[model samples]
Target: MGQRVAYYRRRRGYSQAVLSGLVGRSEEWLSQIERGARDIDRLSTILEVAKALRIVPQRLLPGPFHTTPRQTQQSGTIGTAPDVVPDIETAMLRYDGIAGLVGITDPGPVNLGHLERQVELSFVCSQTEQWSRMAPLVPGMIADSYHASRQAVTDAEKRRAKTLEALVYRVTSGMLDRLGEPRLPWVAAERSMAAAEMTEDPLLIAGGAWRLAVVLRHSGRLTESTDVPTAAADALRRDDRNATPEHLSVYGSLMLKGAVGAASVNDHSAVRDYLSEVERTAERLGSDRNDFWFAFGPTNVSIHRVWLALELGDPSQAIDLADAVPLDQLPPELAERRVSHLITVAWAYYLRRRYREALDALTEARMAAPEQLIFTGRVHTMLSGMLRRERRSIKHDLRELSEFVGVAG
Candidate 1:
C-alpha cells in the first residue's frame, strides 16, 4: 500500500509536501506511510487518501478484497486470483461463455425459483456496480434460465423463464458498457433481443431494444441506435392508455436513450422530440421509481436533461439543470445513477475549464462508486482530455487523476 501511494505520487510528479497537503497529512506522516511505517487499515482513511490521489480505493489496497459476504463465501471456489481489469477481449469471452453454456445445456427441468433469485441477485450486482463479482455468475444464470424456458410445461412458465433470460443478457449488456468494452456490449444486446422476442412480452422487447440502442449509441452507431428505440417507443406508445409504472418507465427510458443517440449525431430536432417525450413521461410518473431497474421518474428525467445539455455543448445549461435535480429523491441503492450524475457534473466542470472543480467532481464520483468509475472509459477520457488541454494549469490532484486513469501527462 505504501509503495503504491509513493509510486502514484511520484508518477504524478507530486512532492511529498504537495501530496500530504492535498490529503491533509503532514509530510513526515506521508513519508512514514510511504516508507511502510504507518498502517492504513481503516477503510475511511484509505478512501480519503485514494480520493486525494484521485484514484479508486481499490487501487490502494492489496488485490482481491471481498466486498460482500457472498463474494467471500464464493471466493474459495472461484479461486484466489486477483480480479483482472476487464478489457474488450474479456468482455467478448463473457459473451462467448454465455453462448457456449446455452449450446451445451440439454433441455432439462430447471429450478425456476432458484433461477429467479439468481436473476434478482444479478440485477442487484449490476445496480451496485459489482462488475468483478457479477461477471462470473451471469453465464450460468443465463444457461439455467434458458433451460428452464425450454423445458417449461406451460406458456406462462416459459415466458417467465425466458423473460429472466432476456434480463440476464440485458444486465450483461449494461455491465459490458460500464466496463468500457466498446463492441462486446452489442453482442449481449443482440442476445437479449432474441431472448426477449422468445418471451413474447412487449415490455421485455422494449427493454431489450433500449439496451441495444444504448450499446449502439456507445459504439457510435448513432443512426441505428436512434432507429431502434424510436421504433420500440412507437410500438409501446400504442398501449399508452393503460400504461403501468413499469410501462411508463421503460418507455421513458427508451426515449432518453433515443435522445442521447440523437444528440450524438447532432440531430437537434430529434433530440428535442425525444427529450420532450421523456419529460412528459416524467411528469406522469411524478417521482423517482426504479421500476424494472430503469430508475425512471422526474428526478431521472432531470438528470438526463443535464446529460443531454452536456451532449449538446451547453455545459452551463447542463450545470443549471443538474442543480434542479433532487438528489435526495435519488434512491441510495441506485449507485449507477449517482455515479453518472457526478460524472456529468465533472464533464460540465471540465467543459468550463474549471479543472480543480472537475477533478473534485470526479473524485466524488469515484468515492460514490469506485468500481464503476475505475472501469468507465468516459471518466478516463474526460480526465485525459482535461490533462491534454490544461497541462500548464494542472494541479497536483489533476496530475494524480491523470496517472490514476492511465493518462500520460
Candidate 2:
C-alpha cells in the first residue's frame, strides 16, 4: 500500500508536502503512509488520497476488491435498492478503470447501431427503477461505447458513439444518485458533460448540465444548483426556432430543476418565474413526453408544482394541486416520479393532520416503487413526523407501514 501511494504521488508529480497539504494531512503522516509505516484503514482517508492523486481509491489498493452479490444483499442500509448495490459498485469500479473509458487494441471495428440500442435499453432500465436488471449491463455498455467511439473511421460515427457514451453516463449518474452515493455521481455527471462537449450537441450538453445540477442539488449546493440549470435554460432559449421536441423537453426540465433549487433556498420569485417558464414550454410541447428520458411536459410540470409548493411550506396548496393532476396517466417508465409524487401527497396529508389519508398515500407510494420509497429521505421524514405526534393516535396500519419502511413506530 505504501509503495503504491509513493508511486501514484510521484506519477502525479506531487511531493509529500504538496499532497499532504492538499489532503490536510501532515507531511510526516503522508511519509508514514508512503513508507508502509502507517495503516490507513478508513474508507474516507483512502478516498481522499485517491482524489488527491486524481485516481480511483481502488487504484491504491493492493488488488481490486469487489463486494460479492451475497454481501450486497446482506448490506441493506448501504443502498435502498439493495439488488443494485453490486452493479453500482461494479459500474463505479469500471468508471475508475482507464481501460473502461479507452479500450485497448481498437475493439476491432464495433457496430454503432447495435451500441445505440444497448444504450437505449440501459436508459429504460434506469428510468423504470429496474436496478437489478440494469446493474449487470452498464459497465460493458460503457466499455463498448468507448471502444466504438475510438475505432470509428468517420466523424459522424465517432460523434454518435460519444453521444451514446454521454447517455450511458447520465443513466449511471441517476442510478448512483438514487443509491445516495455522492462522489461517484459527480464523477459520472462530469464524464457525461465531457462526452457531451465532444459531441458538440446542444441538446446533449443540456442533458449533461441537467445531470450536474441534480448532483449539486443532492450535495446541498443550492445556489450553484440553481445557477447551472438557469444558464442551460438561457442557452436553450436562444436556440428555440431550430429546437426539436427533445430540446424543448430538456429545456423545460432544466427550468423545473432550477425552480426546485430556488424553492430550497426560499427564493419564491425565482421559483415562480422558473415554473412559469416551464408551463409555457409545456404548453408549447402540448403534452407530456419522456424526451431524453426526462419525462418533461404538462403533467411533469404539475408534479413539480406540488414539489415546489411543499418545499415553500404551502402543504395545503400542494395537496390541492396534486389532487388536480392525473398522476395515474403518467407513463409506466416514470415509476420513480410517481413514487415521489405519492410520497409528496402523503406528506401533504400528514401536514393537514389527516393520518389515515397519509398512510394510504404512503402505502401507494411503496406499492408503486418500493425501493425508491424505502430509500427516499422525505418518506422517512414524513413517517417519523407522524410517529412523533404525541397527541394524535397512530393507527395499526400506520405503525405497520412505519416498521416496513424501517422507521421507528
Candidate 3:
C-alpha cells in the first residue's frame, strides 16, 4: 500500500538487480513490481521478503486477506464434499470468450489460477450439450487462473494458486488427453515474477518457475521447459539458504520436468536419469513436512514417472511403478491426482481389451473419489461410446462397470 515493500528491500542494502537475481527475475521486473506494474504470486516469496527487510506481511499488505471469504460456504457433498456451485459450473459455461489468457502485464506470463479454472471449467464444459462452446475457453481460463495466482502471496493466496495449478495439471497432463493442443505455460514462468518480487526468496521464486517448466513440458513445449528449471536451480544454489520443503518441492518439480521431457522425446536414457534426479530431489527435500504446498515427495514424482512411462507405451514400467504407489499417504489436496490416475489406469486396461482388469481398476478408482470432482458427465459421456465401440467388449461382466460409472446396464 505504501511502497513500504521497496523501502524495506532498499534499507536491507539490496538493489533491484541484487534481489531479482536471487529471486530469478530481471532488475527491470523488480522495478515494475516496486512501481505496482506487477503482481505477487507465491506466499513463500512474500514471507521471504518480509524476513529480508526485517518486516512482516502486514507491512506490504495494503489490505490483508479478507476476514471472511468472498463467498459464503456452500454445503459440501458427501464424498468429495460440497457441491453448491451448481451455477459456478454455468459461469464457466457462460465464459465463452476465447481470446486466450494474456497472463500478467510486462511479459504476459501464464497465470496458474487461470489454468486451474480452465481444468475445472473444461471438465465441466466437456459435458456441455454443445461441447464445442466450452472447448475454446479452456486455455484462456487456465491462463486467467495463473494470472490470479501470479499476484497471490499469502497462505490464502497460495491455496488459490495451488488449487488452480493442480486443476490445470489434472486436465491437461491427467484427464483431457484426447484434445491435442499445446498448453501455454507463459503464465507460470512469468507469474514467478510476483513470487520473486514479493518473497525475495530465490527458492520460492524458482519453485514458481519450476511449476511453469513442468506445465510447459506437459503442454508439449519440451525444449523451453527443459531449459527453464536450471534458472531456478541456479538461483537456489546462489541463495544457499536453509532448504525449506517449499524450496525442495520446487526442485522436485524441475526433476519432474526432466522426466516429462525425456519421456516426451522418447529418450529412455534421459527419462531414467531424470527419474533418478527427481528421486534424489525428493530425498533431498525429504524433511520438508510443510503439508499443503510442494509436498509432492518422491511418490508424487514417481506417479508422474509412471504416467510418463504410460505415455511412452511402456505399460510394464507403468505397472512396476504403479505397484509401489502409496496413494493413501498423499495430502488431501492431492485427492484429484489419485482420482485421475485411477481413471487412466483403468482406461489403459480397457484400451488393451483386458475387460475384467479394466473393470477392476475402474471400481478402485470410483471408490477413490466417487463424487466426480465436478463433471460426472464425462464418465457417463464415454460409457455409451465404449459400448458402441464394442457392444460386447465388456461382453460378460457389466456389474462392475455399471457400479463404477453409476450407469445402469
Candidate 4:
C-alpha cells in the first residue's frame, strides 16, 4: 500500500503534504497510506488522493500480483477466466468514469485521469467492455499488431496473429464510428491497412478501409466515405465467397455506416437502398459459425436495425428493435450496446417533437453507458427543431445536456 502511494506520488512529483491537502486529508493519514499501514481497500479515498496526485487511479490499486491471471480463451469461444474478468471489469468502470468526464459529468483533471486509466487498464485485459471499453484503444492495438507481425515465430503464427489484430481493429472501429468519434476510427483504419498488407489479407484490409471511409463520411467527407464501402464491396465481390466471417463483418459494418451516413443527410432513398444491403449482408453473415468474436448475432443485428430505423424517421420501430436485445448471455456487453441503442431511440423521439420521451430515453442511455454522450447531438437537433415547430423553447434542458458533454447549447 505504502509502495503504491509513494510510487504514484513520486511519478507525479507530489509531496506528501500537497496530496493530503488536495484530498482534504491530513498528512498523517497520507503517511499511513505510504507506510503499508492502511488497508487501501477503501479505494474511494485512495482514488481521491491519487486524483490529487494527478496519477492514474489504477496506479494505486493492486495489480496482478496476488492473482494468478488467466490467458485469453481460445478464439470463437467464451472466455470464463475469473482473474482476467477483474481487469476487464475494472476497465469498464474506468471507461464509465472517463465517459462521464467527456460528457462533462465532471469537469476536472481527476475525471480526465479516470478516462486515461480506463484505456490503459483495457490493454491489461483480453476483453474490456465489449464496446466503449475496447473501442478507444483501436489505434494502439493496430500498432501492437504491427509489432507482433515482425515478431511472428512461424508462418502460420504470422497469419493467425495478424488476422486477430485486423479483427480487433474492425470491431473497435465499427463501434467507435457509431459512438460518434470518426477521427479515432480513421487511425484504426491505417493500422488495419498495414496489418492486412503484412498478412496479405484483402478482407481484413477492406474492413479497416471500410471503417475509415465511414469515419470520413461521418466527419462530413461523405463522398470519400462512400468510396470506401464501394471499394470494399468490390474487393469482396472478387473473392471466392463474399460470405466469409471477415468479409461479412466488413461488408455489414460498411453497409451500416453508409445507411447511417445517408440518413444523417436526410436521404431516405439512399437509406432504404442501404437498408436492403444491410439485410442481405446479415443473411450472408448468418452462415458463419464463429460465435465469440464476429458472431453478428440476432442481438447485434437488432442493434443496427434500431439505428437504421432511427435514421429512417421511425422512432417506434427503433425502440421496438432496441428493446429486443437479449441481455441474458452477455449483460456487460449488452449494457454498452443497450446504451447506444437507446440514444438512437431518444433521437427518433427528439425528431418527432416528443421532448419528455426523448429526455426519458436519453436518461436511460446515460445510465446504460456513461462513457460517451450518446444522445448529445440528436437531443440538440430535436430541441432546435421543436423550438421552431411549436414556438416553445427547451433551451434550459439543452444547456444541461451540453454541460454534461462539455459543450455549449
Q: Which predicted model would earn the best lDDT?
A: 2
Worst 10 residues of 3 by lDDT: 63-72
Give the alpha carbon lDDT tens digit for every residue of 118-173 in model 2: 77887876765655556667677766776766777789987888898899889888
lDDT of 1 by residue, 80-159 (tens): 11133244334345434465664564746777788778778778777767666677776567557656666777888878
**lDDT score for residue 402 of model 3:** 56
How many clashes in each candidate? 0, 0, 25, 5
For candidate 3, write residues 44-154 as lDDT tens digits: 355455655666554654321111111112212231111212232333333223224522242365555446545656545332211233434545554465455555668
Pick the winner on lDDT between candidates 3 and 4. 4
Whole-model Cα lDDT of every candidate shown, in order: 0.73, 0.76, 0.52, 0.54
- Candidate 3 stretches greater than 4 Å from native: 1-189, 192-198, 238-241, 287-292, 331-333, 370-385, 391-409
Q: State the lDDT at 104 in candidate 3.
A: 27
TM-score of each: 0.73, 0.75, 0.50, 0.52
Q: What would the TM-score be for candidate 3 when compared with the true structure?
A: 0.50
Shift of residue 198 alpha carbon in model 1, Å? 1.7
lDDT winner between 1 and 2, please give it: 2
Error of 2 at 3 (Å): 40
